[model samples]
Target: MSSRGTDVEDAVDSEVAAPARGTGTRRRVGYVAGLFGLLLLLLLGAVVVLVAQGSIAIPIGEVLRVLTGQDAQSQLSRTIVLDARLPKVVAGLLAGAALAVGGAQMQTLFRNPLADPFVLGVSSGAILGASIVILGTSGVGWLSGLGLVSQLGVTGAAVAGAAGVLLIALGIARRVGDPVVVLVVGVMLGYLAGAVVDMLVYYTDPDRLQALATFTRGSVRNVTWNELQVIAVSCAVVLVLSVFLAQPLNALLLGDRYAGSLGVNVRRVHFLSLASVAVLSGITTAYCGAIAFVGLAAPHLARGLLRTADHRVVLPASALIGAVIVLVAEYVAGGNGLTKTSLPLNSVTAFVGAPVILWVLLSGRARRQAG
Candidate 1:
């Protein structure tokens, strides 16, 4: 063949052998879409089961009907599902999603598999902020009697405390330039926050102690619609912000220096990501009482199931998985009538969370990542 003809043939072969980049992109998009659809279905099924299993024991069909504003089996069924169970179910869903998203961000930003809102002591800071208000104002009225104003006050306090701790952690992280050192620092900070909270509770009036204890232990059963509005608004806004963070966080997975080289603005991204975590974790801790390991476990589970750490898939998947975990825990922890006495959410969450922690450490993911 002539030289020009041979070059033309080679070019044609190359073009035939390689897939178009757009086609690969579309295939990935479709796979992610299917994954999200499956997760949404699982979350919906969980919500139905949780709503149906409470003291009233409505059927899933009745629960769905009531939710859709259609007729239930009876007016009483409607009242039970709508007026009573709906708020709690919704609270669990929002709080779970919020915490899980926060944890996923934390893990990526810190580049530590075990990083989470609770581990960083953000929740403890939130609890401390809440305890100060609750215990400080005990003479005025118990938390149950304090109206919307007090609710808002407590929520504000929690957010402030969480943000404060987050900033401190990030500052230290910047100084040390070591994820392991920063993780230890965060744990110590959490201990300090916990100590402060304990001391505040110790001096608190007996009447206020029970309420404070309940808040610390965590429960969604008592979250009223009024409370849900605060949680829903704050969590929804922050969750949307987290969506924008996905791309920046994905870059960060390659390490800060690499991410910075890619124009990720490492410092700014860290600030924004940590801020989102503060809002999500703080508000959730305020309303639901440090619901525990959902934040830590859900993100890891999402990554494991999806087999990717790409924030786009992991973030939403973590949210759905977190929602399912919380709903399931609520059901098992006496959100259902299967047990006479209700258990705190942490009781069940610890089951999922503790194992994951051990696995991460034992498998050397943490050591390898930190190294």
Candidate 2:
């Protein structure tokens, strides 16, 4: 064929290929979007059920009435639904979403599907950080009595602690380049942080120990509206910030070298991602205690359900899935009056998280070095 005719044929082929590529991309996006819609519905249903079926067992109709500012059957039902169940539900929602998003980011940043804030001891660091302030200030009667100030102080401390551990883990991963080694280092750091917390607890008075005990076990039931305000505000800020991280993180998924070639600052992306993980994990730990496995399992579940590692889809989907998991866990752990004695959140999350960890190990993902 003449050179001009060959060029014309190539142009036609290129035009045809473009539409097929666009169609495939649109199909994937649609699938993920549909999954997200379903997840949102599940989360909504879980919230309604939690609010209506808690210890007092308010009817769904009554709960809806109180929520919409309409009158319930009785003043007592209104008080129970509005005052008590609402805050716990809000806390669970925010905390779950925060952890899941953080996990998605961490998994991407570390390039390990198994990496999660809680699994790597980031939560332990937060607990230790909050313990210092809670223990140190307990002796000062006036300081301990300063409610909001004291709460913020502890929250701030927890954030700092989580950041410290995350930085250390990232540093080690940078040096070692081995995901397994870095994972071990994170566990050691967590144990070290926990050891320090134990020392502080030993010196703390009996009165203080009771509070620490409750905080360590992880429960959303005790979260008051004031505390929920702090968790909700902080989580909302970090979650929004995470939206910006999503594109960079998806770039990093290819490998630091490829991401850098694509104009991504690998170091800067790593820093910001780990920082977000720290904030999400720290604040949740400070308020809800070190609820486990939500961080470790939710991202994996997001990926599995959506069948893609695209952070744009995975991040939000993970958040909704995490919220559902935590709310359901709370309900099963006696929030719904299934049992008189409440169980810790970790107890429930472990069932989901442990198997995921095992799958990662067995699947050879953990054998690869960090990217």
What RMSD does model 2 have? 3.4
lDDT of 1 by residue, 246-338 (tens): 998999999899999998898888888888888888788888898887888999899988889989889999999999889889888998787
Residue ranges of candidate 1 with Cα displaced over 4 Å: 1-16, 19-30, 139-142, 365-371
By TM-score, who's the top model here?
A: 1
Global Cα lDDT for candidate 1: 0.86
- Where is model 2 more than 4 Å wrong at Cα? 1-26, 139-146, 365-371
* Cα TM-score of candidate 2: 0.90
- Residue pairs whose backbone atoms clash in candidate 1: none
How big is the positional error of residue 354 in model 2, measured in Å on the Cα after superposition? 0.7
Candidates' C-alpha lDDT: 0.86, 0.85
